[model samples]
Target: MSVFVTVLSLSSLATILAALVSLADYHLNDYGVCTININGGTRTVDVNGGSSILSSLAKHKIFIPSACGGKATCGLCKVTMVDTISPVLPTEEPYLTAKEIEGGVRLACQVKVKRDLEILIPGEFLTVSQYQAKVEKITKLTYDIKKFRLRLLDPAQMEFKAGQYVQVDSKLYGAVREEVSRAYSISSAPSDRKAIELVVRLVPGGICTTFLHEHVKVGDKLTLAGPFGEFYLREGADHLIFIAGGSGLAPIRPMILDILKRKLDKKMTFFFGAVSRKDLFYVDYFRDLEARYPNFTYIPALSGAKPEDEWDGEEGLITEVVARNISDPEGKQAYLCGSPGMIDAALGTLREIGIGAEHIYYDKF
Candidate 1:
């Protein structure tokens, strides 16, 4: 036989073997199935034993709070390992403390379900379920921010705390092939259980925000889950201070409104910060509330105002304004929502004004 023919035959055989190997790996290398014993076997889920625990649980409609969408960057999907605990991974170290690691806590997004596992999550999470919602209205709040009112289609109504958040799941679009979920604080009063509102600011190059702004329509149906986060107002404080900037106003609005609607005896002062006149929004609504409710006060601040903007309110950074107006924060509870920088600055300012760290609650964007 000729050398060229022999070489050709060998090359063809090699390609065939490679194809057969791939086929076998796809069909025969299955991880089988494993059972997840949850909350002391109060609930058990049998699932394929290869994917991350986050994805596995999600498949069973068991949604864990994940701000970064299972990337393990947010570290919000932590679950206690009841049966067996894996060693702490480096990706999880930044969010976990030594004490947490010692307690067998792990980020569910980072843990692989290779075998039968036992885990523990909060009872509240077990109650959380996915909802079908239709966008009832889309109102522009500011140049970059928009308010979305979603009416619940399934289960008819939702029962979320005023300051809790929901994860909106966006359908695949453009380069995105799989659905994506992003957490946004609910801006509607809890009493309005049939519909929930969210104020979203457009983020440059953000997948979900881009989809929301450009593609979603007023009547579009969307999937969302939750009532997540621990940023709700606690009872018993005599005075309440709400400070927010940009879309951070979401949670604060519902909280303040709930207080006003219930005619709570507690006094509330809301400090809204903006870079200029155009950056501010919801001025009329809050102003109206303030006028009608004697215990409610609305203060809008502009840090950098143009002459044509005709702004007259607190000036300088929001933290500075908060510190200047509020003197004794001894018995006051503060709810702050803003960027990380603003949140940190506000925390420091609150600390300086005799406010205990325990009383200063915040949600950082």
Candidate 2:
């Protein structure tokens, strides 16, 4: 009976100690409130001082472009710190250049808010806002690619450039217990203020992509923030060259439509690359546009055409086709959106064709 009593007493004592320890730890670690001074005190926000700067700013409706959901992988949430809070983390090294580090630029997602901070945010990010949107429709563009049209609910309007992207936040669904956010370029024209379209390709085991591809449905509500990135069309160029592959066509499509709708005095030639006819999308759309617009041309190239595919388009790589078509790169600006490999190869090819590096703009995924 004494032994049983002693065990019970000890267990009760341990439980009390554990609870006290947890309470003490919470009090000790509680930073209470902290202030974030933005852009030299142009704006200030008071937040609870335990979360990341990204989340803290987000709580105040100040959205930073973070594609990896605070994982520090996307490296898009960069802000300049006026005062140093901590040393640069190992995770931020890959994203920061020497100049950026020297200028006190740090990843907002990785920087914890332990105390008051002064940071500089670009003026463009000041206009970014979060919106509650509904998945209005889903269109299958290819086997792995689908277009998601999201209609804004609260704000009902989003003013964004032709090539800017938005970050879609995913919720806990099925096996995906942790929420995530991924960036997708807007495929709709900027004039379409009520809705924005995102073209997403399945990335095997990608967290957001898998959730979007498998679990998301029409009328499903989602939280998204945006109008990020600077991959838009620039004026002053009479001739434009647009190169895209796979889902890269998202931004390019909007730029093309926007330009045509505005009736810009520009000649556009779009070179779309795919593996085969199955990979090609918007062929008829661009073909119809080409037929209607005398200044527009659509060229679809197949790199790995098969016998059964019955392909008779440009039977070569995109770069090869581009080289064969364009004889003069003078007064022309090139816009490319694709994988990093394709961007690098296209850069080399464009440079070889006498296009200056400054005349080329690309958004490499």
Cα misplacement distance, residue 238 of candidate 2 (Å): 1.2
TM-scores for all candidates? 0.91, 0.90
Strongest candidate by lDDT:
2
Poorest 10 consecutive residues by lDDT, candidate 2:
356-365
Q: Count the backbone clashes (under 3 Å) in each candidate.
A: 0, 0
Per-residue lDDT for 333 in model 2? 96
Q: Relative to the unseen true structure, what is the C-alpha lDDT of residue 313 in candidate 2, on a scale of 0 to 100?
A: 83
- lDDT, candidate 2, 193-251, per-residue tens: 99999999899888999889999999999999999998999977899999989999999
- lDDT tens per residue, model 1, 1-365: 59999999999999999999978866776768989999998899999977889999999999999877887767899899976556889999988899888888899999988788989999898888899999999999888999999999996799998899999988888887777789899999999999999999999988888889888999999999998988998986989999999999999999998888888899999999999999999999999998988889899998898899888778888988998899997679999998888899889898899889889888654
For residue 181, give model 1's deviation from the true position in Å.
0.6
Q: Model 2, residue 250: displacement in angstroms?
A: 0.2
- Best model number under TM-score: 1
